[model samples]
Target: FRLAHISDVHLGPLPGVTYRELASKRVVGYVNWQRNRRRHMHDAVIDTIVADLKASQPDHLAVTGDLVNLALDGEIEMARHWLETLGSPDDVSVVP
Candidate 1:
């Protein structure tokens, strides 16, 4: 049986943030995202990986942590949607 392992998706198109949301550690994270992380991590790359994994028909998929950046509620929700698109929770084990 095939088992696929994926991690650190850092899924993005980060949700709109208000100044209030950037009040604490988020400020640091937001700056990092804006300055560096955003350019390197692309949704298209994740899509391509998902497509390839699906085509390979893995029997089980294991996803580790760091699925989202800043850990915002919206990011969690979006990651949930993205995970569903990849596979059911039963088929894909998620740790983040």
Candidate 2:
């Protein structure tokens, strides 16, 4: 069977929040996103990857950890949507 394994998708379109929302480790993550992560993490890349994966038509897909960056509720929600776009929970094995 053709199994496609992917990890660290880091789905984008971060939620709107103020500085106070960023607490503890979130502060570091917010800073990183503002400084570097945002630039490198592109929706185009994800779209391309998804299109390629769809074209490949893997029998099963394995998605490892780190689907979100800071684990914020919004990030989690967005990731959920992203996963749905990939496939059903039965078709994709998510480790995150």
Candidate 3:
């Protein structure tokens, strides 16, 4: 069977994060994403990758960690939606 493994997606343009939410260890992640990740992360690149992967039509897709930058509720939901776009749960296995 063919398996595609993708990790460190780090999809950005983070959600409207608040100071309260970044009150702990998340502060560092929030700061890093705001300062560094946002500039480099591109949805177009991700889309192109998804399109290519779909074209390949692997039997299964295994997605590892780093789906979110800040681990916020919105980020999780965003990850969920992104995951849905990939395939059904039966076809995709996530380690995040």
Candidate 4:
């Protein structure tokens, strides 16, 4: 089986609330800052991974934990969209 292994995608091309410019930076919170700052990097990572997967043309794809940084509901959708590029739901399987 031509299997593709991937992990820690953290898909995010969304506009997260930026806190760097805020005067009350202390109130922004760590999670919020990370979410916004990491969005671009995460997005690039996902794009590169997906492109690699497509070029490889694997019969199956596998992903480990941390698929999403914050585990947002929409993150699951983004992951689904990327996985769909492999084939279809019926063709893919996950351990957990």
Best by TM-score: 3
**Quick one: best lDDT, which candidate?**
1
Stretches of candidate 1 exceeding 4 Å from the true structure: none
Instruction: Please rank every candidate by TM-score, starting with the best.
Output: 3, 2, 1, 4
The whole-model lDDT of each prediction reads 0.87, 0.84, 0.87, 0.60
Give the winner by TM-score: 1 or 4. 1
**Clashing residue pairs for model 4:** none
Error of 3 at 71 (Å): 0.7
Instruction: Count clashing residue pairs in model 3.
Output: 0
Q: Which pairs clash in model 3?
A: none
Model 1 lDDT per residue over 2-95, tens place: 9998888899879998898888898998888999889987798888988888899899999887998888889989988988888777898988
Give the candidate order by descending lDDT. Answer: 1, 3, 2, 4
RMSD of every candidate to native, in Å, equals 1.2, 1.2, 1.1, 5.8
CA shift of 57, model 1, Å? 1.4
Q: State in Å the error of residue 42, model 4.
A: 2.9
Pairs that collide, model 1: none
> What is the lDDT, from 0 to 100, of the residue 22 in candidate 2?
86
Model 1 TM-score, all chains together: 0.91
* Cα distance off (Å), candidate 1, residue 14: 0.8
Report the C-alpha lDDT of model 4 over 1-96, residue by residue, as the tens digit: 798877655556533433442335433433563656465556567777768876987887776655544444565677677667656777666543
Residue-level lDDT of model 2, residues 13-63, one tens digit each, is: 578866777877888888888788788787888889888987899999999
